[model samples]
Target: METAQNQQQAVCGKEALDLLNCVAQSPYDQEKCVALLQSLRQCVLNKKVKKFSLAEPHKEQADSSMIWSKTETWKWSTKLSH
Candidate 1:
Protein backbone atom coordinates (compact mmCIF):
# COMPACT_ATOMS: atom_id res chain seq x y z
CA MET A 1 0.00 0.00 0.00
CA GLU A 2 2.75 2.38 0.88
CA THR A 3 4.55 1.64 -2.35
CA ALA A 4 1.46 2.44 -4.41
CA GLN A 5 1.02 5.73 -2.55
CA ASN A 6 4.64 6.64 -3.19
CA GLN A 7 4.22 5.96 -6.89
CA GLN A 8 1.24 8.24 -7.07
CA GLN A 9 3.19 10.96 -5.30
CA ALA A 10 6.00 10.64 -7.78
CA VAL A 11 3.68 11.04 -10.75
CA CYS A 12 1.96 14.04 -9.22
CA GLY A 13 5.28 15.61 -8.33
CA LYS A 14 6.46 15.33 -11.93
CA GLU A 15 3.29 16.89 -13.24
CA ALA A 16 3.59 19.76 -10.75
CA LEU A 17 7.17 20.36 -11.81
CA ASP A 18 6.25 20.45 -15.46
CA LEU A 19 3.56 23.02 -14.85
CA LEU A 20 5.85 25.17 -12.75
CA ASN A 21 8.57 25.10 -15.40
CA CYS A 22 6.09 26.03 -18.11
CA VAL A 23 4.91 29.04 -16.12
CA ALA A 24 8.43 30.10 -15.35
CA GLN A 25 9.32 30.09 -18.99
CA SER A 26 6.25 32.07 -19.99
CA PRO A 27 5.24 34.16 -17.04
CA TYR A 28 3.16 36.61 -19.05
CA ASP A 29 1.29 34.03 -21.11
CA GLN A 30 -1.50 32.19 -19.30
CA GLU A 31 -2.45 30.39 -22.52
CA LYS A 32 0.92 28.69 -22.72
CA CYS A 33 0.55 27.15 -19.27
CA VAL A 34 -3.09 26.10 -19.61
CA ALA A 35 -2.35 22.66 -20.99
CA LEU A 36 0.32 21.94 -18.42
CA LEU A 37 -2.00 23.14 -15.67
CA GLN A 38 -4.72 20.84 -16.95
CA SER A 39 -2.30 17.94 -17.03
CA LEU A 40 -1.38 18.51 -13.41
CA ARG A 41 -5.03 18.83 -12.43
CA GLN A 42 -5.86 15.54 -14.14
CA CYS A 43 -2.98 13.79 -12.41
CA VAL A 44 -4.09 15.16 -9.07
CA LEU A 45 -7.61 13.86 -9.58
CA ASN A 46 -6.61 10.47 -10.95
CA LYS A 47 -3.99 9.88 -8.27
CA LYS A 48 -6.22 11.18 -5.48
CA VAL A 49 -3.41 13.44 -4.41
CA LYS A 50 -4.58 14.91 -1.13
CA LYS A 51 -1.60 17.15 -0.54
CA PHE A 52 2.06 17.70 -1.37
CA SER A 53 4.93 18.56 0.94
CA LEU A 54 8.60 19.33 0.63
CA ALA A 55 11.25 16.60 0.51
CA GLU A 56 12.77 17.58 3.81
CA PRO A 57 11.45 15.39 6.61
CA HIS A 58 13.09 17.47 9.27
CA LYS A 59 10.71 19.45 11.49
CA GLU A 60 13.00 22.46 11.35
CA GLN A 61 12.43 22.95 7.62
CA ALA A 62 9.46 25.18 6.90
CA ASP A 63 6.87 23.61 4.62
CA SER A 64 5.82 26.36 2.22
CA SER A 65 3.93 24.18 -0.21
CA MET A 66 0.36 25.37 -0.68
CA ILE A 67 -1.51 22.20 0.07
CA TRP A 68 -5.09 22.08 -1.22
CA SER A 69 -7.82 19.49 -1.27
CA LYS A 70 -10.77 19.15 -3.68
CA THR A 71 -13.04 21.06 -1.38
CA GLU A 72 -10.54 23.85 -1.01
CA THR A 73 -10.22 24.18 -4.78
CA TRP A 74 -13.98 24.34 -5.14
CA LYS A 75 -14.27 27.02 -2.47
CA TRP A 76 -11.56 29.06 -4.10
CA SER A 77 -13.27 28.91 -7.51
CA THR A 78 -16.62 29.87 -6.01
CA LYS A 79 -15.04 32.92 -4.39
CA LEU A 80 -13.68 34.01 -7.76
CA SER A 81 -17.15 33.76 -9.33
CA HIS A 82 -18.73 35.96 -6.69
Candidate 2:
Protein backbone atom coordinates (compact mmCIF):
# COMPACT_ATOMS: atom_id res chain seq x y z
CA MET A 1 0.00 0.00 0.00
CA GLU A 2 2.79 2.42 0.81
CA THR A 3 4.55 1.48 -2.40
CA ALA A 4 1.39 2.25 -4.33
CA GLN A 5 1.12 5.63 -2.70
CA ASN A 6 4.75 6.37 -3.50
CA GLN A 7 4.16 5.40 -7.11
CA GLN A 8 1.16 7.72 -7.22
CA GLN A 9 3.24 10.56 -5.84
CA ALA A 10 5.91 9.94 -8.46
CA VAL A 11 3.28 10.12 -11.21
CA CYS A 12 1.92 13.37 -9.83
CA GLY A 13 5.38 14.89 -9.59
CA LYS A 14 6.23 13.85 -13.15
CA GLU A 15 2.96 15.30 -14.45
CA ALA A 16 3.64 18.59 -12.67
CA LEU A 17 7.19 18.71 -14.08
CA ASP A 18 5.90 18.03 -17.59
CA LEU A 19 3.36 20.82 -17.23
CA LEU A 20 6.09 23.17 -16.02
CA ASN A 21 8.29 22.27 -18.96
CA CYS A 22 5.43 22.95 -21.37
CA VAL A 23 4.90 26.35 -19.75
CA ALA A 24 8.59 27.13 -20.05
CA GLN A 25 8.57 26.19 -23.73
CA SER A 26 5.46 28.26 -24.45
CA PRO A 27 5.16 31.57 -22.65
CA TYR A 28 1.89 32.63 -24.23
CA ASP A 29 -0.19 30.42 -21.94
CA GLN A 30 1.27 31.80 -18.75
CA GLU A 31 -2.09 32.29 -17.04
CA LYS A 32 -3.25 28.72 -17.55
CA CYS A 33 0.16 27.36 -16.65
CA VAL A 34 0.28 29.39 -13.48
CA ALA A 35 -3.14 28.11 -12.45
CA LEU A 36 -2.06 24.54 -13.09
CA LEU A 37 1.16 25.12 -11.20
CA GLN A 38 -0.70 26.45 -8.19
CA SER A 39 -3.09 23.51 -8.26
CA LEU A 40 -0.19 21.09 -8.39
CA ARG A 41 1.50 22.87 -5.48
CA GLN A 42 -1.67 22.65 -3.42
CA CYS A 43 -2.06 18.99 -4.27
CA VAL A 44 1.51 18.29 -3.20
CA LEU A 45 1.07 20.20 0.03
CA ASN A 46 -2.13 18.37 0.82
CA LYS A 47 -0.35 15.07 0.22
CA LYS A 48 2.64 16.22 2.29
CA VAL A 49 5.18 15.35 -0.36
CA LYS A 50 7.19 18.48 0.46
CA LYS A 51 7.61 17.10 3.96
CA PHE A 52 9.02 13.77 2.78
CA SER A 53 12.30 12.73 4.38
CA LEU A 54 15.34 10.51 3.90
CA ALA A 55 13.80 7.99 6.31
CA GLU A 56 11.50 7.02 3.48
CA PRO A 57 12.65 4.06 1.40
CA HIS A 58 13.83 4.77 -2.14
CA LYS A 59 13.93 2.23 -4.94
CA GLU A 60 17.31 3.32 -6.30
CA GLN A 61 20.51 4.69 -4.83
CA ALA A 62 20.46 7.61 -7.30
CA ASP A 63 17.02 8.55 -6.03
CA SER A 64 18.54 8.92 -2.57
CA SER A 65 21.27 11.27 -3.83
CA MET A 66 19.81 14.47 -2.39
CA ILE A 67 17.88 15.23 0.77
CA TRP A 68 15.75 18.26 1.49
CA SER A 69 17.36 20.66 3.92
CA LYS A 70 16.36 23.95 5.50
CA THR A 71 19.89 25.34 5.91
CA GLU A 72 22.04 23.56 3.33
CA THR A 73 21.91 20.92 0.61
CA TRP A 74 22.61 17.24 1.32
CA LYS A 75 24.06 14.60 -0.94
CA TRP A 76 24.43 10.87 -0.31
CA SER A 77 28.07 10.00 0.26
CA THR A 78 29.29 6.43 0.14
CA LYS A 79 32.48 7.47 1.94
CA LEU A 80 30.68 8.96 4.94
CA SER A 81 29.47 6.87 7.86
CA HIS A 82 25.96 7.40 9.10
Candidate 3:
Protein backbone atom coordinates (compact mmCIF):
# COMPACT_ATOMS: atom_id res chain seq x y z
CA MET A 1 0.00 0.00 0.00
CA GLU A 2 1.17 3.54 -0.62
CA THR A 3 2.20 5.36 2.55
CA ALA A 4 1.29 8.86 3.63
CA GLN A 5 4.66 10.07 2.42
CA ASN A 6 4.02 8.53 -0.95
CA GLN A 7 0.61 10.08 -1.08
CA GLN A 8 2.08 13.45 -0.23
CA GLN A 9 4.66 13.15 -2.97
CA ALA A 10 2.02 12.14 -5.47
CA VAL A 11 -0.02 15.18 -4.54
CA CYS A 12 2.97 17.40 -5.01
CA GLY A 13 3.68 15.95 -8.43
CA LYS A 14 0.08 16.40 -9.47
CA GLU A 15 0.03 20.01 -8.37
CA ALA A 16 3.14 20.69 -10.37
CA LEU A 17 1.62 19.06 -13.40
CA ASP A 18 -1.60 20.99 -12.96
CA LEU A 19 0.28 24.26 -12.67
CA LEU A 20 2.21 23.44 -15.81
CA ASN A 21 -0.98 22.61 -17.66
CA CYS A 22 -2.64 25.77 -16.43
CA VAL A 23 0.17 27.82 -17.88
CA ALA A 24 0.39 25.76 -21.04
CA GLN A 25 -3.28 26.24 -21.86
CA SER A 26 -3.22 29.99 -21.38
CA PRO A 27 0.12 30.99 -22.73
CA TYR A 28 -1.11 34.29 -24.08
CA ASP A 29 -3.91 34.94 -21.62
CA GLN A 30 -2.57 36.89 -18.67
CA GLU A 31 -5.88 36.76 -16.85
CA LYS A 32 -6.17 33.01 -17.16
CA CYS A 33 -2.63 32.45 -16.04
CA VAL A 34 -3.13 34.69 -13.07
CA ALA A 35 -6.41 33.00 -12.30
CA LEU A 36 -4.86 29.56 -12.39
CA LEU A 37 -2.02 30.46 -10.08
CA GLN A 38 -4.36 32.28 -7.76
CA SER A 39 -6.65 29.25 -7.58
CA LEU A 40 -3.72 27.02 -6.76
CA ARG A 41 -2.57 29.51 -4.20
CA GLN A 42 -6.03 29.68 -2.68
CA CYS A 43 -6.17 25.97 -2.11
CA VAL A 44 -3.00 26.34 -0.16
CA LEU A 45 -4.17 29.38 1.73
CA ASN A 46 -7.45 27.85 2.89
CA LYS A 47 -5.79 24.91 4.59
CA LYS A 48 -3.36 27.05 6.51
CA VAL A 49 -5.54 30.06 7.16
CA LYS A 50 -5.38 29.39 10.89
CA LYS A 51 -1.66 29.97 11.01
CA PHE A 52 -0.09 33.40 11.16
CA SER A 53 3.37 32.65 9.83
CA LEU A 54 2.13 32.39 6.25
CA ALA A 55 3.96 29.11 6.10
CA GLU A 56 2.31 26.35 4.10
CA PRO A 57 3.93 23.00 4.69
CA HIS A 58 1.48 20.69 2.90
CA LYS A 59 0.17 23.36 0.59
CA GLU A 60 0.64 21.33 -2.57
CA GLN A 61 -1.13 18.38 -1.05
CA ALA A 62 -4.08 20.35 0.21
CA ASP A 63 -4.39 22.16 -3.08
CA SER A 64 -4.49 19.00 -5.16
CA SER A 65 -7.72 17.63 -3.75
CA MET A 66 -10.66 17.01 -6.15
CA ILE A 67 -12.74 19.58 -4.27
CA TRP A 68 -10.48 22.40 -5.35
CA SER A 69 -12.36 25.45 -6.54
CA LYS A 70 -11.84 27.15 -9.86
CA THR A 71 -13.79 30.24 -8.86
CA GLU A 72 -13.39 32.47 -5.79
CA THR A 73 -10.00 30.86 -5.39
CA TRP A 74 -8.13 34.12 -5.72
CA LYS A 75 -10.32 35.54 -3.03
CA TRP A 76 -9.17 32.78 -0.71
CA SER A 77 -5.55 33.55 -1.51
CA THR A 78 -6.23 37.11 -0.47
CA LYS A 79 -7.54 35.79 2.84
CA LEU A 80 -4.27 33.95 3.49
CA SER A 81 -2.06 36.96 2.80
CA HIS A 82 -4.21 39.20 4.91
All candidates: TM-score: 0.50, 0.42, 0.35
The per-candidate count of clashes, in order, stands at: 0, 0, 0
lDDT per residue as tens, model 2, 1-82 = 5674353344235446555565766445877777787876776666555432343333344433433334655432122112
> On residues 5-81, what C-alpha lDDT tens digit does candidate 1 reach at each position?
35333436667767766766734578768988899889777777666544432223222322334333211110011
lDDT of 2: 0.48
Give the Å error, residue 10, model 3. 5.1
Cα lDDT of candidate 3 equals 0.44
> Residue by residue across 1-82, what tens digits does model 3's lDDT show?
9886555342233443466566666346777667767765676655444322212333533433322334422111112334
Please identify model 2 stretches exceeding 4 Å from their true place.
1-11, 51-82
Give me candidate 3's TM-score against the actual structure.
Answer: 0.35
Give each model's whole-structure lDDT. Answer: 0.52, 0.48, 0.44
Off by over 4 Å in 3: 1-16, 49-82
Residue 71, candidate 1: Cα error in Å is 34
Candidate 3 shows a clash count of 0
